[model samples]
Target: MDSLRAAIVDGRNTAADDDQFIERLAQLQHEHGPMVCRSIFQTLAGIDLPRDTAEDYWRQVLYRRQQLSRILGRNVDLMTAMCDFLRSETRYLPHPRLVEVDSFERIVYESMYDGLTGLFNRLYFDEAFAHQISLAKRYNTDLSVLFLDVDDFKTINDTHGHIVGDVALKKIGAIIKKTKRDSDLAARYGGEEFVLLMPHTESINAFILADRIRQEVEKEEFTAHDLTYRLTVSGGLASCPLNATEPADLLHMADSATYMAKGSGKNTICLFKKDKRRYLRVKLMQPVLIKEMGFNDSQAYEGKSKNIGIGGILFENDTPLPVGAHVQVSITGRNNAPLLLIGTIVRIESFGPNSYDIGMAFSFKEMEKIATAEIAQFLKEGA
Candidate 1:
């Protein structure tokens, strides 16, 4: 019981010995999961070990690790590592087999990490997203997720070959690891796509971080054989309890924002803002016949639908419609049946003479009478 206290107490052991103990503890925790204070602590108090004493002992260990981390380098995020270990261990129901299962650390690592980039895999990311969202909701803290995708990655693969593409992905992964805070999580959401979970972070900070990563990606040069190429990334930022209240909603919003950045032109960062009137617009190409309602006795006008959302539709029309005009739009559904929707003109843009783009917000008050669900689902799926 006196060994650990004697080893760490003032003038009892050399600094080198202290370093070795801390390193060993970290390694042991990694291989066999978290260690209880009884396993690491040797006290000189000669008092009985209280059931509540482990937490205080753990705090001491973490305090020492914090100091060691500063001395060792920025490569380690002690608090983050500690949090991960604690979170993992606490989730396990106490059992001898459960402990043995946790000890199979290599299997867990392989399952949770992406084989290609060594970042958190999609499965692990889903778990993290849920965990972070729950914490954010319970504590009312700011949490943001960043969705990033390499710009024109398919072109890179086609031009340089898949080998070159692999190299680029690995390089980008390294950059993400280097750039992100230790407390933040980097995950490979899918092919050429990455997501970051930033705990206790605001949208502005997340945007700045995303921009920094975008700039870094843009400036990075990759060499494959005799050819050198540069790449860029597009990013989207969405915050919890702000842009969305659920994990799926948050992810969708971030993805929608990323799509928006791609649409605006790549190599940019976009922040997701919940639209008061619109959910998300999905690009669709369909011919529509529009008739002006109320006070208009004119002929029906033809327009091409650009995008459709639950809240509105953007379409190109040769005839300019007044912003306040009420109209009826008829379009063919996926089932080849004509679907009708009533909307109010909300926006208009002219690209050339006799060519105008119009935006209309559907009046949802009467949408129940129409089969809009099937049409919306088709558009959303296509989008």
Candidate 2:
């Protein structure tokens, strides 16, 4: 109640918009109950009234104020009525000292947001991340974190000067904001890095969003000093309950995965590998056909499966595929029938002069049960 009074007094003194003042009153009433409106009405009316009567009068006042606002095409002042009532009752007038509501709001906004990129700063992200972790723990929901770093950021600064580098960072920040979901929280995690907190999301979904942001950044062009250049970012995703429930551990996993993405040649997204032993991996050197998801059969290339697992497969290919690229894999099943599976390339490493080892995680949500069952059988036979 005292806080409500202080807010009202502050609003009144600042010559705040009447509509904003009314909104504050409405918010206070929502938080503290009808007692807020009742107190305001009783005090202004200068009469001791029952709770119901005071609340009823307050409601009527609100309705009339709305009608007058519509008729006047502007906010109708409730202060006028309060002053009139006090004068008619020969009561003492309420006086509020001068306070700057605009300045206070600005201060609060600046504290939480970065002035350069307009994204949440590190301090705000830390506080919000802790709160989200608590909520996810309480609800047993999934939470994913995406860590991204600009590829060759120092090179951009050194080659084009700090002003151009700042422009590139700002452009990347805008791209992230445009690509991410409204519920996701994006923050500048200091110096060429950003973090995204996605509540109630799994690693795969987080990967999709992160990759989209990466692609957007790659495609965007930044111009400063009459020179235009493009930027790319590498991202890593880790989820709670799937990776680690501990916040620090999950964040570290994401950061480490980002480093892996950078090591794998940047501009890609990597999912944190929780454990290699989670699924039974069978050593099976078999010929498999591979192609990007939307490509034609003629465009499909042949790769040999070095190992197979219920969750994923490790294959050796002549050409290296980008991490996070969706691909279709066709492997010969035990029945001699070809088993086609859709999966995402998660890891890639050069094996030889013309060969690369590619790790693919299966998209179980899109795969049929029979396909997974067949893979299980193959793993069992090869185990």
Candidate 3:
């Protein structure tokens, strides 16, 4: 009730649209109109407003004004009548100090919350992130940030339409809201991207939560326009005073971890691990197409990427390509764009009865570009 009153006062001071406030007012009148009318009528008409009749009268004025007019066989502005009654009886006036505070609060609310999801916006995130960092630094507390991206979100938008895309985003928001604690801060970082700031939390705890969110989203089906679609998200989590000491570095680390998660698979969560390897290998669960360079081998072999790094990749092959044999590796990017790399078969190990683990070392300069700074950072941290 206090919050409701504050919101109403804020709305009035900020010159916000009055429909929401008016509706709230109507509901309040409907619920407790008898005692309210009795107090007001005594002040104005010097008489009691009958309980039984006043309840119905206020209900009609609040919720059934149009129907009441028809029933009474007369058109009347019930809102004005109610307000006039208040004006004559109650000294209904907005306090100047309260209005000033209300206006400030409205401004803050608009700036902090996302217009669509009702989650905190990015602007507020920057402040919160810095504040959390300060608290962690001062008190030696743990802090973690999870950076998540919806898998194949572009495909959802392309196939189901933008409206359905919006539905998916909103559902994800609701899931996060339901899954997270009040202490955690959730923000829509951008389109198809979200950031969860968990203060005084460990990286493993962050990963567990991220995985839970991923699994729940995967299990839930989004229905729109009679089309049902299941979606998944990949997340990367980085901890403060562990992986990073600064805000930008922390965000970068989390984002990098998220990128690795996406590259490895679309529905998994990964923790920031700064591997010492020259090339950071990410587990790729999807199939990769491999072909011998210059069409030397006309047949293209199908293989699943076990892991991918800047300089090399480990993959499964039934008939292992000979060491030193050069081949072209093609995989799908996040946008469904094709990525091609040239590498030499570096190592092969027997895995199963018919399958072999093939390690290929990339030789292309473009391969270097593909291994991002986040991956390098992870490697360096381990180093």
Best lDDT among the predictions, by candidate number? 2
Clashes of each: 0, 0, 4
> Superposing all C-alpha atoms, what RMSD in Å does each candidate have to the true structure?
16.6, 10.7, 20.0
lDDT of 3 by residue, 1-383 (tens): 22223234454455434455456555545653445444333322233457665555455445454654577786545444455443443444222112344565666577668877878888778867886787799888889999989999999998778899999999999898888988888999999999999998765456557767777888998998989878899999998887898999999999999999989966877777776575466888788998875343357989888888765788897887866565778888888999877766656789788899987766444245334543576677789
Per-prediction TM-score to the true structure, in the order listed = 0.48, 0.59, 0.48
Clashing pairs in 2: none
* Sequence-dependent TM-score of model 2: 0.59
Backbone clashes in model 3: 4
Residue-pair clashes, model 1: 0
Name the runs in model 1 displaced over 4 angstroms.
1-103, 276-383
Per-residue lDDT for 122-182 in model 1, tens only? 8878866886787689888889999999999999899888999988998999899888988
lDDT of 2 by residue, 1-383 (tens): 32333344555556457667777777767865666665565333334556676567666667766766788888777855454444443334355333355765566567667888999888878867876787688888889999999999999999889999888888888988999998998999999999999999866667767877887888887899999788889988898878888878988999999998999999988888867577679998999999885433437889999998877899999998878777789999888999887877767899689889998877465355334654676788789
- Top TM-score prediction, candidate number: 2
Reference-based lDDT, residue 306, model 1: 94
Worst 10 residues of 2 by lDDT: 1-10
Candidate 3: pairs in clash: 274-378, 274-382, 275-378, 275-379
Best-to-worst order by lDDT is: 2, 1, 3
Which regions of candidate 2 deviate over 4 angstroms?
A: 1-98, 274-307, 314-360, 363-383
